[model samples]
Target: MTGIATSCATSPTQPSGVAIEAEKIRQELAALTALYEERNNQFFSHLHPLLEGSAFFKESVQHDFETFSEIKMNIKITRLEIRKEDVWTSVYWEGTWKVISDASPLLQSGQALFIFSAESPPRLMETRGESPFGVFQKAGTPAADVPISTRE
Candidate 1:
């Protein structure tokens, strides 16, 4: 009975490989998000390459963003979900985003793109369409839906 209770109370641990990979993905997600907090053009400049090679980055068309030049743009990811078409093709994501720029805070959202294709590599992905979360339009899309104040 005690053994059963312990097993039920605590979820079985995942294999070491899965644990490690999951952690790696978490770290990657964190790093991608951190790019937004970077000042001036640092964020866009540094994160561009990472955003270019993913199918999900449908919006990160090469010529779209020369720079992620913003005065004070910050976004916090609120949700993330993943789906895959096959072992080689999978989708990585985020659900919510919040922005704190200059001197105010606003709730916004965004999605990212990635490709695990070793030869092609993965990108941070980009976004499109109007957003309700805030002023972050991934890499290629417009920020019109997002307030300009937040864009800066």
Candidate 2:
């Protein structure tokens, strides 16, 4: 079975495809978080090349940057898991976030769902549960989680 052996040898030895995808998404998230936390928009260009916009591009990416600047909130990804389907990959992610100027001394948790291409950069296709205030707000209702971060 030389042919079989050759094919096996040529194949990748990664543990799980989902894990790999999760890691890539993690990196991207980390970079974005750092930018917001640091409030440094000068480096925005670094993310421009990697941006893979889908139908929710404006609401998810563009508005996100704007919101980040408005509220000065920071994100820390706590967990991320990915599942692969026939034609798409779904990701569940949780993060600890807080406003830079808030009185809260500790971070709070928030989560979001994303569907991507399952390839490099993931090419974000869809997103759900993206709170503009970053999981922290006066009211704890899903609908009340407005897409605006209030500094006061």
Candidate 3:
């Protein structure tokens, strides 16, 4: 982060640091897809040097390592927005993942917000996701720590 040179917002036509950072995240996702397929640890470098993904992220990775002999993932960025006043970025994305041993491939998608400090890596602040099976959100419980209503 410290190494990132500050760029002047000279023209609307020119890309800003936010754009460049988002692109870097895109590259990381692509690399992660390849790494997941290969079950390689080298993908670590591609992630934010310090990542604060949701509990689901940790669980999903652990589940993959424990349950799957082969795994594949694909992340697509549908849209991204970055705020200049703050170090936060919001991304809307979709993804598909499969457990090769399972009977069918699994598809999942989500929207996430990230916080990036000047010298530190970006952190995944929160996310809301849905899969073929259910929905997930990275957030606190409702008032009084009650579960959200499942009723329609």
Q: Judged by lDDT, which candidate is best? A: 3
lDDT minimum window of 10 residues, candidate 3 = 140-149
lDDT by residue for model 2 over 29-101, one digit each (tens)? Answer: 5665566455455324333222332223333434434433233444444455555631122333333333344
- Which ranges of candidate 2 are over 4 A from the true structure? 1-14, 40-109, 132-152
C-alpha lDDT of all candidate models, in order: 0.35, 0.42, 0.44
Clashing pairs in 3: none
RMSD values, in order shown? 9.3, 8.5, 10.1
Better of 1 and 2 by lDDT: 2
Please write out the lDDT profile of model 3 over residues 1-152, one tens digit for every residue.
53353343345677767676776556544565577566565544443333423334444444555544555444456556555522444445454444456566444455544343333344333333332111222231111212122112
For candidate 1, report its TM-score.
0.36
Instruction: Please tell me which model should have the higher TM-score, number 1 or number 3.
Output: 3
- Candidate 1 residues 18-104, lDDT tens each? 344444455554554455443223333323343443333324322222233322323333333333420121233333222322434
Residue 47, candidate 1: alpha-carbon lDDT: 33
In terms of TM-score, which candidate is strongest?
A: 3
In candidate 2, residue 138 scores what lDDT?
30
Worst 10 residues of 1 by lDDT: 85-94
Clashes counted in candidate 3 amount to 0
